[model samples]
Target: MSLPLAPGLAGTRILLGISAGIAAYKSAHLARLLKKSGFEVRVVMTEGAQAFITPLTLQALTGEPVRTSLLDPEAEAGMGHIELAKWADVILIAPATADLMARLAHGHADDLLTTLCLATEARCLMAPAMNQAMWRHPATLANADRLVELGWILLGPDAGDQACGDVGLGRMLEPETILAQLLDELEPARDEALRVMPVHRDLVGRRVVITAGPTREALDPVRYLSNHSSGKMGYALAAACAERGASVTLVSGPVTLSTPPGVERIEVISAAEMLTAVESRMPCDLFIGCAAVADYRAAAISEHKLKKTEDASGLTLELVRNPDIVATIAARPDRPFTVGFAAETQALETHAGSKLERKRLDLVVANDVSREGVGFGGDDNAATLLWRERERTRRHTLPRQPKTALANAIVDHIADRMR
Candidate 1:
């Protein structure tokens, strides 16, 4: 599928940096994808990259002349690097070789790409592509981390088979993945302009707490009662808030989703444990109850496996209610903007509206979990946001998108409400 370009990139200039690596072949596809997505793409190559991919290939895909030299007289009409730097909305380097990474880390600007990178005020993203061992080496990892610290978005060196008959994690991500990430970085909802607004900074120094995933209530040590929630939505919220300069604490139930880049994560297994985790982060600016906590738990613990008798058809077990974490937090005297999620199978609005009132939430995000490709483990989600006032309800039908995109949208709504 053709991924959507960043809204900001329409008619926007993008400088594509291709470095020497076997993965340089993929840069041709990356350029084509960028052009198809409405970007005015300009390709810049290093001397080493020319060995793997011809300039003719990139020139054809980009529909623009490729620039590979810092000393080109025609390109230097207006101080080439500075002009190119000012022309771009973003600088993306794919197949960023280990050598190039080291040069960037040490502030080396010997080549055209590095020079443009250093001179640009635009956002920068790098997709590192190298041999597995080179990627794993301490120096490369440290350089990558340093780039991140300097505000560069590192796309990936995903794990997979390598060209040299070896495999483990140094493969450059597919072109589509890199393009998707670039779109995200370029279209971040909470832009720098928003940051300077007085209303935007309301949650500036506030500690925001969130819960995510399905809590597993053990029926036995081997089995548990849990839903199919992937914890993606909640994790996305945590990451979004953190990006907007909020101090965030994520109390997450058992999930495979990685912790969002800068947020603090506390892991828990059962509903009771989740309650404790939420309670511990109280008196924050915002509290989000996104976890699908089990309403009932096994009343008694079992020390050992119970034997099934041939004569018995079934076994009886008592159940008890788990603590209502959101309600409890809302009841606090100094409550933050309380948000809760209502995943319903039927009568979505009516049920969500009632839940919003009963739970005393500032806002509730309700969705039909019954719909295919929207809720639970799916990457995309569609939600109807209901405010406590009862008269205002907005339907936000997010396209089948990455969880992070949905998360950004959710946080943007919250930020708007705060205003």
Candidate 2:
């Protein structure tokens, strides 16, 4: 199905930057899609990119001469790079390789594509493509983080099969998906209030507190209990709130994700530590308890690692219930508007609704973690928002999508309810 075009995208100018990767083949289809969608399309090809897809093919699709050189005498006569930079409303680089990301992050204007990226005042979007290992490497992660810090948007390095027979994240998102993300950024939410608002930063002057990641409950000095929460959803929500001008404080548990720009992050490990950290940032305009806190902890922690005796078949330890962070917050006399997340294995809606009533939460975001790609450590999510509204309960289901997009949707709902 064709996607709906946003009102703000009328007469939009797009400069498509293709980097070298096996995913470069997808760029041809991307260029055609952009042109067919009524965007004024232009193409820029890296030298290595020419080996995968010829400039002539892209030129044919875009109806514009593909530019590949930083030193083209004819084009440079008019300072072509500067002109191209000014003409675009957005620069979209598909198959943005790890090397290209590193160069861009470090301000390397050594090639035509990089040079134009440096010169452009336009918003930049990158869809990274590489091997799974490379994508997960610390260096690449740091580079990607730095680029985001510099106001660049990353679409996806979606998880799945790759050209090299490796299966994991590092596949560039499909062209349709990338275009949808771009459209979302360019336009307001399809709501009357957001459409008429002068500034899209709806959370301005609001204080938001978020909890994230899996809290570790120590059983011994060397052992702990935790979950597979990667903190992606919570972190995405934090970024969305910050983008809307909220003063956000993220009370995070153990996770390797970087702190979103414009957010204050407090690091903790155990559930108790997380509770203390969250309580200290209380009385905010909104509070989202997104953390996957452990339900139990060792009643008596062993200072030393427990060793299994050969004669004993198994070892047993006493356990105690951990404090329920979200429930406690909702029970507060002066509680802020509270939201909780329910990661369920069955009866998604039923459990979510129960959480809403039982915990006294203003809203509960429910997701089935049993699904393949939409929960737990994955980058995408589909959720149902359950809440009580006067005489009836309301339920809104969000389809499977990148956590970034889903986060924005959740924030929009929250903002609407607040209004």
In the range 254-298, model 1's lDDT, one tens digit per residue, is 898876543567889999899888888777778989999898999
What TM-scores do the predictions have?
0.55, 0.55
lDDT of each: 0.80, 0.86
Model 1 Cα displacement at 267 (Å)?
Answer: 0.4
Model 2: residue 29 alpha-carbon error in angstroms: 38
How does residue 272 of candidate 2 score in lDDT? Answer: 95
Q: Number of the top candidate by TM-score? A: 2
Residue clash pairs of candidate 2: none
Over 100-144, each residue of candidate 2 has an lDDT whose tens digit, in order, gives: 999999999999999999999999998889997787676887787
What are the RMSD figures for all models against the true structure? Answer: 10.4, 12.4
